[model samples]
Target: MQETLACFKAYDVRGQVPEQLNEDIVRRIGRAYAEAIRPGNVVVGHDIRLTSESLKQALIDGLREQGVDVTDIGLCGTEEIYFATAHLGVGGGIVVTASHNPKDYNGLKFVREASKPISGDSGLREIQHLAERNVFEATAKRGGYQTADLLGDYVAHLLSYVDITSLKPLRIVCNAGNGGAGRVIDALEPHLPFTFITQNHEADGHFPNGVPNPLLVENRSPTTALLQSSNADFGIAWDGDFDRCFFFDAAGNFIEGYYIVGLLAGAFIEKNGPQRVVHDPRLTWNTIAVVEGAGGEAVQSKTGHAFIKEKMREADAIYGGEMSAHHYFRDFAYCDSGMIPWLLVAELMAQRNQSLAEMIAARAAMFPCSGEINRKVEDPRALMRAVEAYYAQGCTHIAHVDGLSIEFDDWRFNLRSSNTEPVVRLNVETRGDVEKMKQKTEELLRFIDG
Candidate 1:
């Protein structure tokens, strides 16, 4: 109990197991969640983490004891709980997962009705307070529990995003990083025409292939190498909870997620009507141009799933995409799905008769960018101010949606401090000049490191 349960983060709860997080702490959190939300029924699921089972059990124990009926979907990704929560008309849901953190770490993510996230600004803080208090009223009656299989319905929902039969039989590389995504891929295999060349395709809680985060350049190696060796069409890699997915093209080149935002925006705009598309401000010129060019309205929102989901719901947007590889769908109750983006991309390739590389190359050339660069600093806020002040001399445009985005003659960059880390994130892009983009990025890096 001495360990600071600083486990509750800005977006979700994540901490080292048994110390900051354990069965006892999770039990309180579960009870606190039930007490705060007061749902009659709730859905729960867990990822392939070592402590996930015990943590999930503890959470269920608290909920059941508090007279909240629990429907458990064992050993699944985060999105499955989201789907089941909204689809089943449950009061709320919780998924026990660390989501790409180190093996020694574990956490929980919760959602209210319709699978909407219960972020700190919403309800997570109240739950955290109640849990930290460590006191709860005992319920006289205990609720029932049941195990439900949602794989079939979830798979059908995924397949419904595109015309599966019309998709070409392309050999694609898939690296699940030994996370919970492998099973879902296996389930979808029989229904698709394409052949999957899978790697680390097992449910190993130990994370034998390292943490299942493709965002790290090191983690991209397995998929990139396999894509080249197998001569596959394209490849994808997912994080532990399988909520964020990254992509590699035919030549095994890692595709910056910024471009994928534009790609996904186009597909959603063309398929669903000319509707609002929410985008984060880190790297938005590409997304805005692509969305508006396709007759869809592009709206800017602060980064993070909770913010993006709230904006999408308010705008009634058909789709919302973050340059960080999170894509949200209105049909999915405004929740981000790691599975839908790839499916839509595959279908777009088939319908447009264009290779993944070729289709995106033109857009990439138009908006050459420095994919989010992070820097550790003694004082991140001071660094952001210094960087912004130095660059604002002759800036043509500026925005402060998520951070500081300043534009000049032909280049623009955003420098923002991380909410969770003592680091500053920088993103620079030029209007078609790679050299200019590189120069600006280097200059900004010097300022950030100073």
Candidate 2:
């Protein structure tokens, strides 16, 4: 009730555990969410974080107090909660997870009926205001709580993306990063022909091997080392909550999410012809090329799950992808799934008889990129203004759907501030030229630093 908790982020709830997100605070959030969304029943789930169970229980207490039936799916990922909300006929869903945050941190992701995300522009602001007000009306009937296991259904849904029998025996290194993904992997193993070489595979909120963010170059060594030693076909790593996934080729080379977006776009476009594929603005040349080449239309949407999902649904697109490794499927109720992307990638490779690296190499050559670079700056707005002023003279085009996207004759770049942090992110891509991309990336960094 103290001037709105800082944990309420633009997309979801995330903050340091106990310090910023405690049982009492989460309980208030639960009640506020029920009031704002007015769900008859809500599905609740938690990740492997140590504080998750306690926070979930407190949230359930608040929801039940508000006469909202609570369906508890214990120790699950964000996607699992999304699945439960629709599959179990729950009115809404909440997931207690901080994703790639530290062990001392935790958060929550919310969805309305049919797994529609509730973000800042949607209903999160109202929930924040209500939680801060901390006033609630008593209901005539208090709702009861129940537990359900939706793992089998969730796994079955994931397998629906791939032709299981056509998939050849694959040697895969799956690093769950000591999170909830291992449980899903265990559930899926019996139904597949994959030999999983796992590392830090156990669910431990303590994060013994460090947070499982493959985005951080340092956190990638474990999977890289293990994959090389195991001689696996390819390796995959997921964040704490397992909503996003990172890939490493058979040679233990980390593949950037941008190329994966192109690969996945091509796969979807191949099967679902003329289907629209939504993508984020950052590092888009590759994806656009793939989508158009496959006879599908490419639509650009702002980054973030909420924006992409809404745009995908509006376009009735078959698939949407972000350079950050979040892949959304129209079939998966338009929710992003880390599980489905990998399965699709595996199938694409098998059907095409190509290695993961080989599949990416063709696209990489067409649209080489600088990946995404982040830096802390005092005034991101001022920096972007300077960038525009500097490049405006020769720029051929500029788009600001999510941020500043400037295109010239042979190169383009997008510079934007992080939605959740103070850092400014820069992405540079050149048309079929890697050296130009590298040169432009350094040039932009120098200007930003200055």
lDDT tens readout by residue for model 1, 1-450:
533359999888999999899999999899989999998999999999989999999999999878999999898999999999999999999999999899999999999999988998999988888888877778988988999999999999999999977899889898899999999999999999989999999989998879898888877877888988998889999998898889899989999999998998888888777989999999988999999999999999999999999999999999999988999999999999999999998998899999889889999999999998888998887877887788889999878888898998889998888888898888999999999999989988887766
lDDT of each: 0.91, 0.91
For all predictions, the C-alpha RMSD in Å is: 1.3, 1.0
- Residue lDDT tens for model 2, 57-175: 99999998899999898989999998899888779999999999889999999999999999999999999999888998889998898999888889989999999988988999999
Q: In model 1, which residue pairs have backbone atoms overlapping below 3 Å?
A: none
Worst 10 residues of 1 by lDDT: 1-10
What's the distance in Å from true for residue 21, model 2?
1.0
